[model samples]
Each structure stands twice: as structure tokens, then as C-alpha cells.
Target: MAKRQPKLVLAPAQGIPFNLLVLSQSNVRRVKNGVTIDDLAVDIERRGLLQGLSVRPLLDAGGQDTGTFHVPAGGRRFRALEILVKRNRLAPDAVIPCVVKPADGDVSAEEDSYAENAFREPLHPLDEFRGMQQLVDQGGKIEDVAARFHVTPAVVRQRLKLACVSPVLHEIYAADGMTLEQLMAFTVSDDHARQEQVWELIQSHHNQSAHFIRARLNESTVPARDPRALFVGIDTYVAGGGCVVRDLFEEDRGGWLQDAALLDRLVLEKLGAEADRIRAEGWKWVEAAIDLPYGYHHGLRPIEATHTPPTEAKLAEVATLQAEAEALENEWSGADEIPDEIDARVNALDERIAELAGGSWNYDPAEMAMAGVFVTIERNGELSVDPGWVRAEDEPVVESEPHGEGEGAQREDGVDGDHRQPGLAPESGEDEVQTEEEDEGIKPLPDRLISELTAERTLALQDAIAGNPQVAFAAVLHNLVLATFYYGRAESCLMVTLTKVGFGFQPSGMKDSPAAVAIEARHAMWKERLPESDRDLWDALQMLDANEQAELFAHCAAYSVNALYEVAPKYDNGRISAHTVERRLVHSHVLARAVGLDMVASGWKPTADNFFGKVTKARIIAAVTEGKGGETAALIDHLKKPDMAREAERLMDGAGWLPEPLRTPELPAQADLLEAPATSELPAFLAEPDVSGDEEPMAIAAE
Candidate 1:
């Protein structure tokens, strides 16, 4: 019962006159997809039709030959030829290559058109990408390809970049293993091996975020905005044979310098040269570092030195420049926008004035022999050299006054090198001295009096702590671990713990405070380094080495420190005892002294917003009096509270003033064992958030 073989009818190819070919409405293609008719016409005109059209012979009702043909398929091609003929590029009766089909059969014109339009598969995107890449590889300019394909040069370049991705990743992308965005990110770094490595690393964590990928790829690179990179110009870096990897798909801040080692070397070389240049000033020693950490000059004495005033010629030049600037400002004050030339002139004048007015400090010859200079990079990538810092070890020994048992004995409870009676105080503008009231042990003082005294000690302690961030970090972390792991049952005495460390609740101006900004940046950095999934975090942290772990621990622990003071609620809670709060205060003071935390050195300056506005009018006036003297304080004392606060803030600017909370509390030298033990172990209970009221939820601002 085998079926008879079905006869196959194939379309016939033949040369047809363009004038005889007419478009048929029976064609199935209605919507346009690719290769517009005009483009097709141009393509056909350039290189005669490579594909033939399907056409049906014209016929009458009686099936008589009509001598005219209608095209059922390739209508676009027919129009292309017709356009050529009309343009006189081809004769009216010019021949066109097309496939002819029978007009009266099972295969009708509609069927033929439908088959031609529906059955063909479009080129795959990868194939197209590869095709464009091939054109480029064959020495075809991107512009030429773009013009030929009716696309932009950027499009052409993007296609090429996609095509150039590592073949392994391409295969994975084809299988839908990675997204197009992730693929684009890999193009930022062209190192194929490195790309593959990154892919492998992210596969385990299932993190293919574009930013994460780019960050991992550029982990060892320095951003162009980095001070070192800015100091060493990008062009200079490139000219020095250093490489820079640029992101084509996003704003990468002028790209990243791939050669970090080279940048470091250049920075060092430049800093060294600057040190040498400054050495001619007769400084005993010129210390150079990329960055002078907060409180770097602590424990050192600064010798008083006068700045060398500008010369007469320089002063005259500055005056002339200032005059020019004032004139320019006056001329442009009413204008909506100043002309570029005028603006440039004004800027140049200002720069000249700054150059002439600014000069280096000059130390005496003897002072210079004992003092040294610190050379570091400014935030704006400029060289900064601070002179006249005399190390304690370099200071001349001073003779001590002879004393009996109690006449001028050193205070064992005071800070190192500090010698004063327990209750003794020196008069303003006078040398430190012991008071006779301190002959007997001190009596109990009023709470207000105690607070005032503690406040002063707090400021000094804070100043000392500004130099020891690591020790402070360790101390805070040690306390947090106990409270976290032991919960209510924790036997630890440390009361420090971290609450929410976000700045979302801050006043608008406080958002950009230096401390807040620094904390935010540090948190963001650590956030990016940590794995997305909590499960993977342990492993990710485990991978870090001892130094890296210490750094991470310090950064994490810093958020837990809460040294601010607030009146406790009236409700007596056994959990938050006054005694416990007192202990925390004592511990914080001890920690401050241990770390040498100095608010002034940490760059905190009293202002209306952070200081005066948050405290009483008396406090503001007192701060002004202490920092700027009684005359300055009196000027603002009669104003309304708000006005007085503003005036006081201005007067206290750069006066190294601090509030009671921010000031380091006074603790004896014997109380300096505030550092907590450093351990890498994470307790099982500490892995989860404390939910048993173990940690009091206080309004602690990490800033």
C-alpha cells in the first residue's frame, strides 16, 4: 500500500522585462521589517538582484496568454527595478531576473507570496555582531561600516565590542546564562583572561550585576579622580607607557588607571621631588607621605614661626590684580552672564592675587635645626608642606623647680608630662600652678560643677583620641561582641553597642557633614565588598587576610561607638540603669584617652547648626567666651537666641571648641586600659540581631 510518489513542482527562474512586471495585491507581506524598498533598490542597482522574484504569467478567463506578468513575491525587488527604469538608470524594457510560477495551479500567487514572506529566518543577533566584527577585522573603518549599514559609528563600535567578548562568555550568553548588560560591563576591561576569571568568581555567588562586575574587574585600578591620578596627569601617565581602561557603556569618571603600581611610583617620585625642593629651606628633616592621617601631628609641638610676607614688588602686583578683579566684578555685576574673556580675566587676576599673597612660614635658624617639615598631598591634588613641627623627642630638656614632698610634686593622676595639684588651676594668661585649696583630698561637688569639670577633661581626651582610630575601633568592637553574643546573660561589662547607623534622620545640613560623609563612604565601600547573600558573607569575609580583616573589623566596629549624652527617660528600666550609663561614660572616656581622640584634629569645628543650635544660649555664650574671649562673647550676648547663636558660631569658627558630649571626659592615667581584645571569632548568638532587650535602643549618631 505504498503511496505513489508526489510530484514536486519547482519555481522557474527567467529574465523578465521591468516594464511588464506589476505589483500584486495578493502578496502576503503587509508590515515592513528589514531592508526598506529604497535601500533594496540601491542595493539592487549597485549589484544586480542576487535573488529572483516570483511572478505569475497573466492569463484570461479562457486561460489565453495575455503577454503580461504580475509579481506575487519579491514585490520590493520589482519596485526597485521600476525605480531604476524611471530614473533612466535602466531601459523601460530592461530585463530583471525573477522566478516565474504558473498562474493557474494549486500553488496560487497568494500562497507563493505568503511562503516567501513567512518561511525565511532573519539573521541572528550574534551572527550580525560577528559579521560587523568581520568587516572591522578586514580593515573596514567603523565609519564606513556605519554608513554602509545606515547605522551610527557608536552602534558599530558597540556591536564590535559585543562580538569581541571572550568566546566562552559569548557561548554562555548565547545559552542565556548571562544578561546583555553584564556582557557590556565586561567590555570595560579587555583582558580576556581577567574577564573569564571574573565570570568564574561571580558564578558561585550568582551575582552578575553590571556595577559589581566592573568593580571586580577594576579592583586593582585607581580612579582617574583619585588624588594621585589627578596629580599625575592622565596624558602624562599614558605617555609614560601606563594603561588606562575606559568604560564605553557608562560614565566612569574619566576611566580607571590600570597601572596602580606605576601611579604609586609616580606619586612617590613627585612627592620626593617636592620634598627635595622644600629641603632647600633648611628644614632639618622633610617627611613625605601620600596622606597624613587624622591627628598625624599629635604628640609633637609646633614652634611659633612668622610667615614671610610678600615682597614690595609682589604686594604691588597683588594690589593691581585685586583692582582689576574688582573692576571686572563691577562691570559684570548687572549682566546676566559675563563674557568668556572677561570671566577668564577675572579668574586670572584672582589667581595672581592668591599667588602673591600666599607665602611659606619662616622659622628661626635655631628653630629650623630642631624642627621638621611634613610634605603630603592636599585633597585637590596639590602639594602641601607644613613646617615647624617639633617632635617631643627633639625638644630641649627644661629644668624642673626644686620641691619638697608636697611643694612641687608631680601629679601621678594627671596625664604624662602634666604636673598640677588635684584641685589646682592656673589663672588665665599665667603659667600652670598648684592652688592651696588642693592641700586636702577633694570634697564632693555639685552635679553641675562636676559636669562642667568633666566637660573640659572630655575635650582634652577627645583631642588625644583623634590619633588612634585603630585602638578606638578595637575597643568598640570588643564591647559590641559581648553585648551581642551573651545577650541579657552576657557577662561582659562593656556597654558599647551599635544601633542603626544611617543618617536618614539628620537635619538637612548635617547630611553632608564631614563625619557623616566619611562614615557613609566607608559603609558604601564595605557594602560593595560584602557578598549580596548573607550566606555567602561568611565565606567572603573568610577570604580576607589578617590585615584586610582588621581593616574591615575596624570599619564595622567604628559604627558601634556612642559617646553622645541625653537625659534618660523617667521610667526606671532594669536594663538601662543609671549605673550602666555611668559605666559607659567612664569606658568611653577611657577609650578616648587611649586612642588620643581629638575633636579639633578630627576636623570638627563648632557651628550654629551642630553646636549652638542644639544647646542652651548660656552654653553658646560660654563657648564663645572660652574660644574668643569675653569681648567677643559680650557682642553676641544681648542678641536674641537665634541671632546670638549665629554670632557665636561665627566667632567660634576654627576656635577648637566642642560641646560637653563631644569633649573627651577626664580620666586618670591609670584608667587608660580601654582597648578591647582583638579576636576574629564570631559567636553563634552574635550572628543574629539582638532581640532580648540586650542592647538599649539609644539615639546614637555614628557621625
Candidate 2:
């Protein structure tokens, strides 16, 4: 410990003439890498050599200094200076600052070169970003900084913007707690507090991806493409004191809209203005909402308004479009996949022709007096004005003076007051005074009320006939015979119409449903086979085989099936007698039974997303009990609701079970053919959640 240590000696600093400097062959840098000599030369020309070269004097056979120097470490730098001199940018005798090593030292030129290459560390990307930011902050122009770094201005700016991220995140990135990409995602939102909060939430999650981080930050914000945001233009929203969050790191699809509540208010206000304009048109009521609930049209009557006839110019335009569409279709007659350009052109032509052929319709004063309009935004961000909707209470009522009896009424025996034959009246043998039974007939339903009932009946019939091909053919033949033989005197339950109902409120997932795909394919095939002209449709149908005709009729009738449970109720004021919705559902069940429909076989299953996540623990247990017996269900009964649902989904796979709504009522004959299962007791299922809502929920297991 007491021994003295020798003092460290350093290389002497001196200036050597550029002409006397030469690259050392003993340098350890065998592989050429990093910046090119020309680029370094340009850098040197702009600003003289920043770092001095390491040089050792060459020795003769006697081991004496030869006055000429050789670069052992900074060979690249020496070569760059040589390029500058060759280009005449520097004088041949220019002095180059160098750290001159002793000629007689034990350190070889290769050792010096190895130390120069091995002992240096490359600058981290974050450090570079920060250094560039610091330079810009110190009054340096971005262009000057980019030039110094030999990078594009755009690249420089992107890196410098990284400094805008939270300091904590920067430290995290430096410490390798998060990746550079994730750190970049954090910069999309400038809120340090939000970034920290998101990190705290996702730090323990297995999915700590950059995408997840961005999504968490935008939880309450609306994307630029969101229909509500699109309906309210971003510029208008900004003018109304809304802020837009932009992403500098990537293409952000026009960025997200902050202040979602403010955006919604603006949307509602615009919808209200549109509603006011419609109100001026004398609508009974005009309702404005950002979004209307599903089945908003329930208990209301849809009426078709008189459309303005197409003008000669519009007709000519439609004809031209039709011609173009026909030519395109003929050219691509049997191609499996038409080219996108041709397909798009054909679609555009078809749309334009349809638009030109049809006239825009609006409600007249009389219809508006009895109907209302719903002004809202369509999914495409367009203002949608749904007019000519007559609510039940708004339908007109017929009045009659006090009379002996109603002119039109139905009796308990199903005889109509106006339809009773004179021969059925009381004869001379019977008392002339009217009895209770004689006056039991009630007033018949109004014409509009009868039409609503008939509409529901027609829908039920369509579903019934579609599922039964024999019935479908028979129904069509019956209608034809009635029209041909009995003229207008006959009435049938089945009524086919050219009108097709649109399910605007269909679930988003239904777009890709198996049923939907099949229906769409069949519709396309028929559309392709049919003639362009309506007059030619009859001839085309006659030309089809019997099976083809039956299939086409079923396809058409299938479009009329409306099994959706709508919200409709009757009022006590006689405004509406009944909704007839339950009757429609009963018919749907019957049709389902006839077709032997199996929702499970149709690729629908009770999963955590569509079923379990929305239900209670007890419901999940009950489902498991039904599908996999009480014994198996008991295994997951002790777990928490979430765990229980997951377990139940696993246990119930391929069990052919269905939720209540999706279940088709069992057929009588099918039920008779099944054997009853024996019941056995298992562990008790969990009780339902308490109604008080104060009890600790999800505590079945200790976290």
C-alpha cells in the first residue's frame, strides 16, 4: 500500500505538414464503415477538421525518426484531408494537428488503432434527438442543425420533436423500460400527465404494444374519420373552440378530435338547424338527435310521397348511363373478378343511372300535416332527412253522427255489420226489439290501421313462404289465379311487393354473417341474369326453368322477412289498436321450426364477447348447466364472474346451446322423438348480484 505509483505519461501534441502525413497499414480498422471519405471531406471543407489525427513517426532500419508521420488511428480523417488537398481546397503544406506518439514506445501502431476503434461508443438515438433539440433551443436554425448532422430537414424535425415528450418517458426510453417506437407513440399526445397515466395502466399488461398505448391515450377522443366528427367539419369544430390532436410520428388519418362532448353538441346543433328547416315545411313534428335509437320508426306508418316525374334531359342522361353500364357488363361477362377500375366504373354508372331515373320526393302539405320527420346524421356523415313518417297518434280519425248502429263493424261471430245478408236478419217470428247480441258489433278498424295490420301479416307470410319452397310456389300460383280468375274480388294473406325494406340499424357484425353473405351472393347472381329493362323482366321469368323460377321467388320473398323485435305499443286513446309485433314473432318461430334452423350450426356460439361479458354470473352458470350439466358447471361456480364466464364458454363449446333470443322454439314432433335426461344434483350455483349495488362485487376470489 505504501509503494509509490508512477505518473501517467501522455502523447505529445504537435502539428505535422499534410504532405508528410500518411495512412498507416498497421491500423486495426481492416473493414471500411461509417461515413464516406467524400462526405467527411465536405464536412472538413465546411468546418476545418474537428478531431486531430493520431500519428507516429516512421523509423528507418536504425530505429530513428524519419521526419515523415503515419496516421495509426484516425486514418479515415487523414484520407478525408487528402481528398481536400487533391481537390485544391487545402494547401499541400497545410499543418494538421496531431497527437504524436514516441517512436521508441512499446505501443505498436496496430495497438493504437485498436484502442481508437474499440474504446469509443456510438451515440444513442435518443441522445442525438435531445442534442439536436438543445441546439435548436439555443437559437440554431433547423436547417443549420440538419446541415451539421448531414440529415434531411424533415428527419431532423421528426427527431427534434421527440423532445416534446415527457421527461419521465425519455428516462424510461433511456433505461430500456420502453422501446423507441412506443416512446414515439407517446409523442402523439403532448399531455405528459396523460402519457404517464397510460404508462401506469399498461406497464403490467402483457399487451404493451405501441398501438395499445396510442389507443389508451385516445380513449375519450373521437378519430377524424368518426362519423360524428366528419359530420361536423374539423375546421368548423376548431372555429367553435374545439382542439384537434395531431400525430407527428405517423400518418394519423387527419388526427383525432379532442373535446368529444363539444363535437357532439355541434353535431346536435347542426341537426337541429336542419330540423328547423324541415319544420318550416309544416311537418307535424321534427325531431333532431345526433343518433336515433334502433326501431325509432316503430309504431309509425311509412308513406310514399308523389315524386316529380323525370324530365326529358334526365331521361336521356339515364339512357346514356344505361348504355355505358350495359357495355361494361357485356365486356366483363364471365370474369371471376372484374378489374377494380372497370368494376368501379360500372358501379358508378349504375348509381348515376338509378339517380337519374328516380325523382327526389318530399312530403306534400297534407302529408306533412299528419306526419313527422327525423333529422339525423347517416353513417356516411351526410344529413339524412327521413320524412313522411306518420305516428300512430297523428293518424287521422273518422267521425260519425249519433246513429242506430255503426255502418262498418265486426260482430262476435266474425260477421261484418255492413257485410251481413238481409236474409240473416231477424224474421217475423222473432221479437223486433234489439237484444244485446244483436248490437254487439264493434266499429271496424280504420283504413290506416287495417293497412298496418296487413303489412305485418304480409311480412309474416313472406317469411313463412320463403322457408317453405313448396308454399312459396303455391302462394305465387294462388295470387296469379286469384288475379286472373276472380279479378279484384279475391283476397289472400300473401302479398308480394316490389318494395324491399332496408335494415339501417343492423348490428355491425351482421354485415359479415353467413346468412347475409349467402343472401348477397344470390341477389347478385339474380341481378346479373336479369335484363336491364323492366319490360323484359316478365319474359326473362317465363324463360327460366321451374326450379329457377321457384328459387327466384323465394329470394324475392326472403327480402321481406322482418324478424327484428321492434318497440311498438298500443295507446289507450284508440290511436293504435295493437302493434301486431308479437304475432310477427310467433310466425317467425313457426318458420324457423319448419326450416329446422340451427343457429349453432349456422356458426353462432356463446362467446365471452357476444354473450358472457354482458350477462351476470348466475346467467353464465345456468347456461353451463344447460349445455354441460350441473356437475361440470359447478367447477367454475366458485370463481369470479369473469373467470366463470370464460370457463363456461370453454365447457359449453359444441353443446348446441343458444341464448334465449337466438333459440328457435322446439317443434312438437321433434320434441316427442327426444328422450328426457336424468337430473342429478351438483354443487349449488352462485346467487345473483345484490340489487343494493353497495356490496363488494367480483370478490368471489381474492385478487
Q: What are the models' TM-scores?
A: 0.54, 0.61
CA lDDT scores, all candidates in order: 0.72, 0.75
Model 2 spans > 4 angstroms off = 45-48, 60-64, 86-92, 139-144, 152-154, 157-162, 238-255, 278-284, 305-365, 397-703
Question: Poorest 10 consecutive residues of model 2 by lDDT?
Answer: 680-689
For candidate 2, write residues 41-138 as lDDT tens digits.
Answer: 99999989899999888988898878898888999898899899899999999999999997668988889899998999999988988898999999
The best candidate in terms of TM-score: 2
Please, what are the lDDT tens digits per residue for candidate 1 over residues 30-111?
8887778887777777778788878888887998978888888988888788788878888998887878887787777898
For each of the candidates, the C-alpha root-mean-square deviation to the true structure, in angstroms, is: 22.6, 11.6
